[model samples]
Target chain A: MNAIQIRTMAKDFILKEFLPGERPENLTDSTELITDGILDSLATLKLVAYLEKSCGIEIAPDELVPENLNSITQIANFVQSKQAST
Target chain B: MTVAALHEYLEQSARRYPQRCAAVEASSGRQITYGELDALSDQVRDHLRRIGVRPADRVGICLPKSIASLAVLFGILKVGAAYVPVDSLAPPARNAFIFNDCGVRAIFVEASRAETLRCELARLAAEPCLLPLDWSDGPSPLATYLARVEADGLAVDESARPGPDNLAYVLYTSGSTGQPKGVMLTHRNGSSYVDWCSDILAPDENDRFSSHAPFHFDLSILDIFVPLKHGATVFLIGEELGKNPTRMASVIAERRLTVWYSTPSVLTLLVEHGRLDARDDHALRFILFAGEVFPVKHLRRLKAVVPRARYLNLYGPTETNVCTYYEIPQTIAEDRSAPFPIGRACSHVKARVIDANGRDVPRGQEGELAISGAPVMLGYWNMPERTSAAFHVDSSGRWYRTGDVVIEGDGGVYTFRGRRDRMVKRRGYRIELGEIETALYRHPAISEVAAIARSEESGVSIKVFYASRDGHALSLIELKRFCAHNLPAYMAPDWFSHQQLLPKTSTDKIDYQHLMRME
Candidate 1:
């Protein structure tokens, strides 16, 4: 999938799974997910599992840091990099 | 074996291994040697006694985690006074309640918090003398106070020496009635568990332990005392790094921590956010967890990361100080759905699942878990009625009712089912649902209220559903603000829902399960 498609898919998955009660309008493309407490430790793992299963991308241990998975845009970029490198 | 007095352990260890580093504050990298810990604690004890601190009296320690805090703790025990720890992060009102309820005569606070301590003391009905410790600044007010005392030739009283039965510390836990209840633990109550830890973890002078849990929490006892007893080094993780998983993993790697103990929530955070598995360092050998259930999936994943590290799940409330433990198997089957067993009882403790009649339940049946052990707390501090209600006496001995439901498994093992009361462990804090409800009830507009813990795969957070009184319209923001004023940040409900009428059962009692499902 393209970068835009990846971002859209990741954002939709996050809204549906990690933040079911959150409003889509309240979240920006760069809104911090981990630091803002939107995705706690458990939710972060669930999101990782979702990305690996749906997007067919393997998240390395180093990539699990907040800089990579902190926001929808960050996650999309990380996924795009992983996809391109693979 | 009867151990020496708790403070004497530090003295003895200092004599045994004076050159070994005793502790390190992670932020500043300041280290305390065993010899300094012994001598400094003696100095603090003399200072405390000079200030009329008598045996059996309560002394409050209200400083951030540092060398001074540890010295004050050992000094309190040295003088035979029960040290009451109040988390500086908690609201002043909560700290005030603990100080008042425990009737502390004096408190040791950080220099930065001297004014806040003064204000809190002023609000109390009785005043507690404040002794400030300056870790950053030189010649603080506390240093001046000590110098003045010395110059005046004030003689220290060396009369009191605490024995096993003497109160070591009183940790305050969340109470259902909105007031915090102090769990009075004696020196014996702690040493009993420390002795067991000595055998289980088997640390030596070479070992370095990571102190992650906050002082107010019971898990801290293991982090602080266990290492001191063995003449090992303790790496103190500050609150900021303790909450952040990436920093936590980095510290463990840098310090080469051999023994790691914390709540499963912290481990889950490190495993996910920090990718704690990525570290190739091999210092960690023992991984101990308590305070909440470790999700099997996370445990399995962590096991994969540190395959050589031995994993153990310890089970008990603050009252019993860990009477049962389960060593996680090397591999958990992918098809297994049940939570791992809580394993067998710890040394010197008896654990059983009993029915309503206090008799052991049949195999595979669910019942309340009761612990009878030497490590059982003396009782709730100054609250006889609550203490009596928490324990049951029979021909055997006093059994502390855990209020936890467990199902018996084969080979004398038990699997945790759930708690029988409103108490729930969220973010590793044992919070009472009634406590949150009481906080919400303090809001004048709240009429009917119910609080429930919502658990997801990651962790648990509380949600409260409430209705305003007649003709009162209460907004969620206003209610949250009210709760913030009365409750600790962790005790405040994460989500709030407004309702015209709270759902009730046929008997007209609030249906908590229904409320839990509502969110």
Candidate 2:
């Protein structure tokens, strides 16, 4: 999938799973997810599981930092980079 | 050496191991020796006294977990005042209620949170004195007060020495009522639990303990004091770091933490995402888990990865401290699905599984567990009715009802059955379902609500079934935001379901069993 497609999918999953009532327009690509407490430890883990299974990417323990999963843009970029390397 | 007050542990440790490292901030790599910790707390104590804080007063601490906060805790104890710690991340309104309920004379808060908390307390009739721990925009910082006290050369006030019965701290827990109730713990109550754990754990000066629990949590009592009593090092784990399993695992390996204590959920996360098998440099000797049951499968995996570490399951409410403990044995049958038992009572306390009539239940039968001994809390703060109702005063002795039903097994071992009340444990936090209902009732759109907790694969998740007053569905985002503003993040409901009418029993009560079936 393209970067835009990846971002859209991840954002949709986050909204449906973590923020059930949140509007799609509210979560911008650059919205702070981890830092803003939108996703807690449990939610973050679940998101990671979704990304790994759906995108067919392996996430190392060190890659679980906020730098990679803090926002939709960051998550898309991280996934793209992993796909490119593979 | 006898220690009457909790702060005396620091005093004794400073004398014995003056130059030994006492605390470490794991994220920032900040370290404080025992001598420095003691001296810093002395400065804080003098500053508190100069600000008109007297013995038996209550002081509120609203700072993130850090070595500096540890010094403030000791300072509060040194003044013979009980410290009330509120979650720095909790809503300002919730914290304001606690500060008001306990009548805290002064609050030491982080500079960033000071303005928000000050504004919240503005609505209270008697506002507490706000002392910012760091640099603030308005009021002079705590450093300034400490500096002024240091320059004045104030003599130590021996008169402020507290007896063993004096209040040490008040830990607030969720109450069935909308308001949170404070569990009052005295010096003896804290020391007894610490002494018992220290004896069993036998941590030495070389041991390094991880302070994973927040200062507001009851688990912090053992995390901070147990290490100080033994002159060991306590590495403070920040909230963010604590949430990241990979980083938490690395911290354990990098810091060479010997004694690790936290809720089982954290450990489960570590087992799932931490990649523990890759790191062999960890010096973990004891791994302690409490609050919720560890799924047997995950526990087996954790044991396989860190086979050398002694695993223990501790059991207690904030009111009773760590009254019962079970040490995990070397091996478990592969097909075992049941979680390990909570084990026998600690040597310092007595545990009895009593029936509804307060009589001891027969072995293999289930009843409420009652604890009576030194570690039992003094009572709920300022709530005589609750304090009296929580205990059974028979000729045998006063026993605090745990509100947890447990079955008596062989050799006096107690196995946890379930809670007798609406209280539920999620991520090591005790949340009262009624508290959520009460908060939701305040919302104009919500007419009737019932909160129920269901055990999910991840853990406990609360579901709130509500009926709207106007026969219209409320926006879920708005409802979530409403809960966020009034309650702590953990206490907020995970799911909101709207129903036209809630099911009721013949007794005219909400049918909770029917709701569970719906789930």
Candidate 3:
């Protein structure tokens, strides 16, 4: 999948799994997930697992910091870079 | 023959093992020797004395788990003052409540949190002096600040060491009334447990213990003080590594941590997500769990992975540090369905299973557990009425009501049933929410479970919220069927919801208030 498709799929998974009751339309691509408490440590792990399984990418231990998983946009970019490197 | 005060023990340890490492930062590998810890604490103590922190005054240690934070704690104790721990990672409102409630004269905060804490402190009625413990990203580090203090030739005042009766620290616990209550623990209360652990656990200078629980929680008492009392090393796990299973397992393997203490939920995380089974070659000797019930299945799984380590279940509330403890037998792995007992009382503690009328319940009967001993807290701070209500004095002795219902079995063993307040009436039947929670936990897919009673216009119904195991998705129908087979018809949860994570209090217990807010 392309970067935009990856971002869309990530957003869907986040809304469905992490933010259960939050409205999908209200969450923008740049919405803060880690800092804003939408995604906690446990949710961040779930998101990483989902991204690796669905997008067929690998997330390194050091890459799990907030900088890479703070937003859907950042996550999409990270996935794109990892896929390209492969 | 007598025991020294907490700070005095540190001084003695420093004298005996001056070059031995006292603490290490797990992530950064920062080490603090006993001599360095003692000297650094003296500097902070001098600073505290200069700022008018007097005897019995409550000082707040709001910094994260680091070498600097440990120094700040000992520094407060050196001044004959009790240190109140405010979890820097917790919400500001909660920290503000503790600062104002305890009437802390000073708060040692990290430089990164100084601005936010200063803003929050301004709103409080009591104005506490702010002491920067260390700089996370700021200009001056704590070591530099201490060196400057020494260079300025500031005279260290005479120590006013607190006695056993004097308060050591006031740990605030989550209250049901929307505010937290501070449990005042004296040096005697803490030393009782530390002394018992020193003799029983026999931690030597070579052992390395992991401080998994936060300083605010009582479980940390064993982690921080017991090792310090015996001149052993302690490894402080930061927030990130505490939750990361892979990182935690690797740290355990790399550091060769000998003793481990944490809640069962944390252990379950390491068991499921962490490659603990693969990283079996380590020095892990004792796996201690408390604060909540451990699922038998999960405990069995963990025991299988760490076959050489001894599994211990400690039971107590915040009022008393571990009153009863049970060492799990090697045979428990085979019979996972057997009920785990909290075991007999400790050396300095007396436990009684009494009913509503303050009479002892016969063996094989359920009653509320009450503990009375030196380990029991003096009382709640600043809340005399609540304190009197919590502790009852009878002809035998004074007892602190644990609020936990338990069955008294043979050999003075007590098996936890549920909390007395957790029982709710529904459709003319009294149902314990913990039972339903235990039933839901038996489901293979359910990793975490919490049940609450919601009374709506229709009627009172039990609502359940759970998180599925890693890489598993659970359906409501399947959960209901599992519950129906395990529990009675009325005991089944009326509603179920899937959550990524349950909100937790600063002590890492499930925040029922936040769960109630979800509805």
Candidate 2's docking class is acceptable
Measured by DockQ, the strongest candidate is 2
Better of 2 and 3 by TM-score: 2
State each model's CA lDDT, in order.
Answer: 0.82, 0.88, 0.80
* Predictions in order: chain A TM-score: 0.91, 0.97, 0.95
| TM-score of chain A, cand. 3 | 0.95
TM-score of 2: 0.92
How do the residues B258-362 of candidate 3 rate in per-residue lDDT, one tens digit apiece? Answer: 999887778887888787889768798899988666778788888888888888898888789899999999867565675588888888899998988789888
Better of 1 and 3 by lDDT: 1
How well is each residue in A1-86 modelled by candidate 3, as lDDT tens digits? 89789989998898787555555776788877765555656668888888899988888766788888888899989999999998
Superior candidate under lDDT, 2 versus 3: 2
Better of 1 and 3 by DockQ: 3
* Top lDDT model: 2
Tell me the tens digit of each residue's lDDT in model 1 across B12-59: 789899989999987668888998777667767788887899899999
TM-score of 1: 0.84
Clashes of each: 0, 0, 0
Docking quality (DockQ) of candidate 2: 0.31
Error of 1 at B253 (Å): 0.7
